[model samples]
Target: MAKPCGVCAGVRRAVETIERALVVYGPPVYARHEIIHDRHAVDELQARGAVFVDDLSAVPDGAVVVFGAHGVAEEAEHDCERRGHDVIDATCPLVLKLHKEARRLADRGYDVVVVGRAGDDEVDAIASRIPGRVHVVSHLADVERLEVADPARVAYLLQTTLGGLDTVDIVAALKHRFPRLATQDGDACSAVHDRERAALKLARRVDAVFVVGSGSAVTTRRLLEIVAASGVPTRLVENAGAIEHGNIDGLTAVGLAAGPSTPDKLVDAVVARLKMLRPVEIDVLDGVEEFVRFRLPSRLRHAGERSSPGLGGAPLAPGAALSHDR
Candidate 1:
């Protein structure tokens, strides 16, 4: 049996809340980017009448646009204002905290090095927040390319969803180059750390580990990397169909986990396939449990204020607690 990953479960719950509210409120709920980076989640929302758009231009003038969980660049927020689209920012608060931290570090005259996928919406915002002060690096080797005015004055910030062990090694390499380089506390989200730890633990108990996640999900890629780094046989599959018969022919134990953005249903399908294949025991390794909850935007909190009527309805209130579907 496949269990829901904490992070994906939380996001799934959040998406359900928004969809239900839209039902009470009407249609054309324009979402900026995949709501949680899961194709299944996006497809489900689309079936329920949510329109996912990559660019703000797809949204008509005065339409309501909801931001995805990964968060958007400040420029995107400004564009929404300029375009007159009613904005509902669903950026995970943990990511927002990192963006703010990166900006704060940049403002203090320190050069910043951001470690993450280049051109990612979140990375772009972190770079934009500091402009000239920030440089992006995806691999550990790229750390040598940092062009800082003073190595001593440089600080490193991470994409909140990056792999935990990978960041440790990357940061170690950077510190070797610049011993005096500053760093922030708890940059990666607790959820990412917890899931990575869970994967590692599960890896020890199984002959092979299968990480179910979308092809483009950054965190999912990291999970695969982490498992492979342990020298265990690991496969990263987008769905159960990718699971070849030969891969699981003789494995007595198999470990299963999904990245933060994956859907619970896809993971379940994978587990079901494994169950049918043989008598292997499925296990969930004990790992960190996170209790963090992100507050919804003001519009989603209160009943009196409706999300602007034209797009769908009026905005939700600031302090409203969304219903949890999981």
Candidate 2:
């Protein structure tokens, strides 16, 4: 049975910030990356005058630019500042917190180990912020190859979207090698923990599993791996259109989940498509109920407040609401 699981608070905040930016700044607003990794969200923003570019060089001088939810390298931020671009930071606050922790660990003279996929945008950003002291490791093998100044003077930071089970093994490996190693104050963001736990529980009870999210999204890929590890057949799709009927044939019951960047509409579309594929009864697999809401950047918040009809007497665009919800 399909369930209602998609779009965490951070992702929802990023999208809404971009939408409000469009409403306030008009056309040609620039985004440094695919605002969140989901194609549907990127396409929708592009259709509404959000121009996404890889490098700051692609954006015009003095234009308003938004950093993506995954965050960006320090060099990218310097470039934006050097180019005189009016920047609206849409980086998720949890990721910002991770970056701060990485810098603090490095400043404390600890050889920092970032436990995540090398070259992932978030991982790169976190590592880049710590300069010469950061090392990235995906598994125990990577940890075995790590060379540091002192085994006792080491600290580790986790990528916010990594699965909890995978993190456990990696953390254990780090601790085994460096008995004095330090870690972040808590587990990865609560959103990551909740979604992964729910997905695993749902995957265990189903004949097959379908994950709705972009292939490039790390969280979605992690979800796919975790579910598949449970011995359940699983597939990762961008949307309902990508589902192949033959692959799901003869399945009596199926489970559905989506990544943090996935929109609710995609989940609904996949659920509707599943019903058309076979006469299956749909049910919601209850999981953790998320209620976290990240505040928008100051610029967007001020603009939204002024643009509200009741506040400044200026009418907002139709369908635009000032509230932030997950």
Candidate 3:
């Protein structure tokens, strides 16, 4: 099983923020993206009257708005200000930290290279913030083709949710080319490394592996890549309902791995389906839960009237986009 199986700290923070906003702001709180990758989680919140929209234009004048774990770009931040929506920024602290590092280097006249996937929302958002020439490396080969204004004035930033040997190798290439490459400390996601290792270990002892998560989420794709690379059959399922008997027909042992954005109920339901499919012993490997905690925006954190009236009701001042953190 995905040893450290639960929502990752960042995703957990986003989920909690939306939940709290719904409680405080009443029905129809708006989120610009799916926020939580798991459809089940979104569906549950939707049933509770949370409205998910594609753009700020869809959000009404008085509704509270949330930015998902995949941080928003500066352009969108400007839109929020114009719309005068009370905003709760749920961008993962790790992402915010990386964004800060990118801007710090860029502001100092350095060309920044971001190690991340193309078309990934978070990567796209990160790239949007850098005002200079920015390069995004999706593969190790991309490093060879990278050209910066000055190798000495170059720094690198990692996609907050990405971590693997490839990133290490690419960063190594950058260092080899630029003697003084400014790399970020603690940019790698330990959650990704831990979950991938757990899934690979489970793959060794199982006939097949089922990764519970949305394929759209980057973490789930990484798990499938690692598991499939191990030569074990792997299937990405959204929940227990996606499981088919044919997929596990002849399997005696099945490994379960969950993406960081996956919810607990999704994993639990998968485990239950596997057990119900046959009379087999189930083993959940020992796991230590994630220790990190990202504080929510003061508005969402005090959804219980602790500063409730001041936080949710008032539209952010013309220039204010995100609420101040506690």
In TM-score terms, candidate 2 sits at 0.85
Q: What is the alpha-carbon lDDT of model 1 when measured against the actual structure?
A: 0.70
lDDT-based ranking = 2, 3, 1
Q: Tens digits of per-residue lDDT for model 3 on 1-326? A: 65886567677777778888888778788998787776777888899888888777888875688888888888887888888988888888778877777778888889899998887778888888888889999888888898889888988887867756447788888889888988776635677777887888888889988888888876788878888999998888877877767878888888888867787777778778877777767688876555565556776555431311211122223443323242
Runs with alpha carbons beyond 4 Å of true place in candidate 1: 1-10, 17-21, 185-187, 240-249, 273-282, 302-326
Highest lDDT against the true fold, candidate: 2
The lDDT per prediction is: 0.70, 0.77, 0.77
Give the higher-lDDT candidate: 1 or 2. Answer: 2
Deviation in angstroms for 260 in model 3?
0.8
**What lDDT score goes with residue 207 in model 3?**
90
Instruction: Name the lDDT of candidate 2.
Output: 0.77
lDDT of 2 by residue, 184-255 (tens): 765467666677778888987888888888888877888788888888889897878877689678888888
Instruction: Count clashing residue pairs in model 3.
Output: 0
- Tell me the TM-score of model 3: 0.85
Q: Lowest lDDT 10-mer window, candidate 1?
A: 305-314
- Cα misplacement distance, residue 69 of candidate 1 (Å): 1.7
Residue 282 CA error for candidate 2 (Å)? 3.9
Error of 3 at 228 (Å): 1.3
